[model samples]
Target chain A: MNLLLLEDADFVAADRAILRDRRLHHLQEVHRAQAGDTLRVGRLDGAMGQGELLRLDAGEAELRLTLDRPPPAKLPLTLLLALPRPKMLRRVLQTVAAMGVPRLVLLNSYRVEKSFWQTPFLEPAAIREQLVLGLEQARDTRLPEVLIEPRFKPFVEDRLPALAAGSLGLLGHPGEHPPCPRAVEGPVTLAIGPEGGWIPYEVEKLAAAGLAPVQLGERILRVETAVTALLARLF
Target chain B: MNLLLLEDADFVAADRAILRDRRLHHLQEVHRAQAGDTLRVGRLDGAMGQGELLRLDAGEAELRLTLDRPPPAKLPLTLLLALPRPKMLRRVLQTVAAMGVPRLVLLNSYRVEKSFWQTPFLEPAAIREQLVLGLEQARDTRLPEVLIEPRFKPFVEDRLPALAAGSLGLLGHPGEHPPCPRAVEGPVTLAIGPEGGWIPYEVEKLAAAGLAPVQLGERILRVETAVTALLARLF
Candidate 1:
């Protein structure tokens, strides 16, 4: 954990917090932290600063916080991803949050297996757990909002156009299309497909919704890699 | 498996190949491939083409190969990465290959755990297995050349200088450095540090070897994500 993230419940006072959970384990084992050691810390959705370890023990560790700095700015992005397989979803969530995506939409595609929607990983608390890990990895405090869309057509046709209206809507598909733009000027609404990619009809539907198709060469990257690649290339 | 990768041992004749291993199971289970099916296939380190499934049984599957197209071109880059923890090493190997990095150097770093170098994943066969999976994912036919450097100073000071001589040598570090360059022409030599980042002395040694330090903003990304992000941005 790069930053010691403190939730409101962990606070005993405005400046004092107690860590009794995995964070304590991390501090004890991974960090091998001791009393008087200063650690980088942040409040969930709040400011980041330093915390001086006041007390260290097996049960819990006490810290005095001075959260002052704001979290890093999130990407000007609303990512629309075709829900990956359950195993991949967890990693993608962590990747998205770590990369500073402000909003993510896990939408349905023809190629997405129906069983994927049943995965426990999509549960709010489970999703939050992965996002928190990402936050800890990146040393950020803010959490990205995640939205689920089980119906592809309704989401694309009814809600997507308005949501994508002001953004540079893009579809990350491998094809005979223009390369994905570099260092884009403003907000982007990018849709990435499932393993086999979006079907031709679905691609047309997305295109009608203002997400023009773009290519990232011939090599087909895994969804997680593709997400990082597209975001990196775009911004 | 996007492309059915065929090794030399799989060949029964000049044009016919039999699959009885994991590939056969993959064809039966994942692809649900049947007799008379035409699948995208690639010969290891050779060509890519269509394979007509002549026979399909529980024990074995037979294919008639018609190799034609050349594999996708590799990037004009050589990547140097501090060896990651074993679990991540497998995924990073796959990512490195999938992204078309023709050469990779797994180098030692101050922050790298001593146990990381002892992983069975570092074994030649184990490494090749991951690389093959990457090639299959990306539909590429060639495996990336992976070199291990257990001694950091000698590799960087004596050998890296010559290896990176004509290329644009860059280091992916997080600090008060210029942003990583985008869309550069010709070859590049990139060095990415380990989890806690390169120590000051190691950075200086690398600098003397021609790799100037560059940053990727404030957010700290995992090594795998950083690799993808850097490659995507640079290329």
Candidate 2:
């Protein structure tokens, strides 16, 4: 873990935190940390600073924290993605979180197999676990809000328009459309489709919802790669 | 598989080919393809075209080949990566190929774990398998050439200079260096470090080899994500 993330449960006092879970194991094995060493640390949804290790043991580690710096700024974008397969969903969650997405909508498209929705990876607790892993990887603290939309039509027609009203709504699809914009000036609402891509009717519906179609050339990238590439190109 | 890749052994005649492998199973089950159905096809390291399924059975499937179209152009870049752990190395190879990296040098770094060099994933056949999967994912034909450099100091000082001579040699390091350039016109040579990043002396040696350091903001990304992000931003 890049930053030792601290939840309220990890704290023993206002300034002292006790890590007894995986963090403790990571400190012992991966870091080979010792008492008196200072490490990067962040409080959940709070500030990031340094922690001076006061005590280290196999059972737990105690640190005196001095959280002050705010977490890194999130992207001024809301990512709407077609829910990938169970295995891919986990990685995408980590990728989205690590890339600093502030909000995400796990959407459905016609091409999304019916079985994908039944995956336990969609569970809230499971989702949170992946997001936390991402925060640890990126050394951030704030958790991105995630929304699930198993039905495509209602979410796009009823909620997306209002949610995307002030943003540069764009659809990441393969076609003869304009290339995805670079270094966009303001907020963006980007929707990416499933493996076989969005059907014609769904694209039309999304277009009516203000998300105009865009392309990233001919090579079809995997969902995770596409997410990283699109976000990198946009910002 | 987006494209049915054809090797020379698959060709039965000047205009025909046979398949009795994973591609055959994919046609039978995934595609549920029938005789006379047309599928996208590409020759290994050659042109891409459409193939008409002439016969289909559990045992074998035959196609009439008419190769003509060229594969997607590769990136005007060479990627130099500190060899990741075996699992990440496989994914990175696929990512590199899918993103159209023409060449890759899997160099060693000070922070790279010694055990990483012993992975069977580094074997030629194993590497080719991942590259083929990448080509299939991206619907490209040509394979990226991979070079292994087990010794860091000698490779950086003795050979990297000439190798990166005319390109915009850049190192993806996390520091106060200039941000990586975007949409450059010429070729590029990018070196991405291992998980914990390159040591100071290693960075110095790379600098002397003509690569200057560049940052990708404060958030640290996983090696695979960093590769995609850097490539997307540069291209």
Candidate 3:
């Protein structure tokens, strides 16, 4: 873990926090940390700063905190992604959070298998676990909000237009379309499709919702790679 | 598999091929392909074209190949990456190939675990397996050249200078360096460090070898994500 993330419940006092879970294990094993060692730390949805280890034990570790710095700024984008397979969903969650996406909408596409929705990985706590890992990887504090949309049509037709109204709505599909824009000026609403990509009718629906189609050349990247590539290219 | 990759051994006649392996199973299970189905196919390190399924059975499938189109062009870049942990190595190999990197050097770094060098994933056949999967995913027909450099100092000081002579040699390090350049013309030689990053002395050695250090903001990304992000931003 790059930063020792602290939840409110971990606090023993205003300035002292105890870690007794996996963080304690990481500190003992991965870090080989000792008392008096200073480590980077952040409060969940709060500030980031340093913590000086006051005590270290097999059971728990106590730290004196001085959280001051704000977390890194999130991307000015709302990502609308086709829910990937269960295996891919976990990695994508981590990737999305690591990349500093502020909000995510996991919407269904025709190609998304119905069975994917039943995966335990989609559970709120499970999703939060992956997001925490991403935050730990990136040393950030705030968690990105994730919204699930099982019905594509209602969400796209009734709500998407308003959500995309002030942003540059772009669809990441492989086709005869303009290349994805680079270093975009403002907020973007980007919709990426499933493995086989958005069907023609779905593409048309998205277009009507203001997400114009764009391509990233001929080579088809896996969903995780594509997410990273597109975010990197865009901002 | 997006493209049915055919090796020379699979070819029967000048314009025909047979599949009895995982490809046949994939055709039967994933694609649910039948005789008379026209599928995209590519020759290993050769042309991409359409294959007309002539026969399909549990044991084998036969196809009539009509090879024509050239594979997607590779990037004008050579990547020098510190060897990641074995699990990440497999995914990074696929990402490297899928993103069209022409060459990759999996070099050792100070922070790289000694056990990482002993992974069976580093074996030629194992490496080739991942690369082939990448090519299949991206629908490309060529494999990237992967070189292993177990000793860091000697490789950087003795050989990297000449290797990086004409290209825009850049190092992906996190520090007070310039932001990574975008949309550059011509060839590039990029060196990405390991998880904890390159030590100071190693960074200096790489600098002397003609690579200038560049940063990708404050957020630390995993090795695989960093690779995708840097490649996408650069080219």
CAPRI-wise, candidate 2 is high
Q: Candidate 3: lDDT of B107?
A: 99
Going through the candidates in the order shown, the clash numbers are 0, 0, 0
Please provide, for model 2 over A136-196, each residue's C-alpha lDDT reduced to its tens digit, 9 standing for 90 to 100: 9999999999999999999999999999999999999998999999989999999999998
Give the worst 10-residue stretch by lDDT in candidate 1 chain B. Answer: B153-162
Residues B9-118 of candidate 3 have per-residue lDDT tens digits of 99999899999999999999999999999999999999999999999999999999999999999999989999999999999999999999989999999999999999
Report chain B TM per candidate.
0.99, 0.98, 0.99
Decreasing DockQ order of the candidates: 1, 2, 3
* Alpha-carbon shift of residue A8 in model 2 (angstroms): 1.1
Whole-model lDDT values for every prediction:
0.97, 0.95, 0.96
Query: TM-score for model 3?
Result: 0.99
Candidate 1 structure quality by residue, lDDT tens digits, B46-97: 9999999999999999999999999999999999999999999999999999
DockQ values for all predictions?
0.95, 0.94, 0.93
Tell me what fraction of the real C-alpha contacts between chains A and B each candidate also makes.
0.95, 0.91, 0.89
Which stretches of candidate 1 lie above 4 Å from their native place? Answer: none
Clashing pairs in 3: none
What candidate 2 gets wrong by more than 4 Å, as runs, is none
